[model samples]
Target: MVEFAALTYGLLASVILSAAQRNSKMARPHPPLLLYLGYLLCGLSAGAALGLGYIILTRFIGH
Candidate 1:
């Protein structure tokens, strides 16, 4: 369940961040594919952090 939740959260984060990135650069024209990948990387990192935090919190609280 934790794994599933992590992936779902990661994907959601990626999409939302990507869209925001795209919109933010409308005046400067669209970015290249590599930039999008970078945004995805950022989102995945955030999700990993969130997942790890959740795990630690649950472990201590459930104890």
Candidate 2:
């Protein structure tokens, strides 16, 4: 599932770049930009999971 999302985003980024390269109006993005965004998203998800786990553990421990 993760691989699919990563590959999908990567392909989308490539398509966007190719289209922009063919036209003059599209501002060229910084190279390798969207990949960083995807990675950040994955990290955020992991962080969220960690936070949730901590909350659950603390609740259980308090009882």
Question: For model 2, how many clashes?
Answer: 0
Q: What number of backbone clashes does candidate 1 have, counting pairs of residues 3 or more apart or in separate chains?
A: 0
**TM-score for all models, in order of appearance:** 0.49, 0.49
Tens-digit lDDT track for model 2 on 1-63? Answer: 989986976776576556556553556554566557546656766987999899999999878
Task: List pairs with backbone clashes in candidate 2.
Answer: none
lDDT of model 2 at residue 37?
A: 59
Kindly report which residue pairs in candidate 1 clash with one another: none
Candidate 2 TM-score versus the reference: 0.49
State the displacement of the C-alpha of residue 28, model 1, in Å, after optimal TM-score superposition. 12
* lDDT to native, each model: 0.75, 0.69
* Worst 10 contiguous positions by lDDT, candidate 1: 26-35
Q: Candidate 2: minimum summed lDDT over ten consecutive residues — where?
A: 22-31
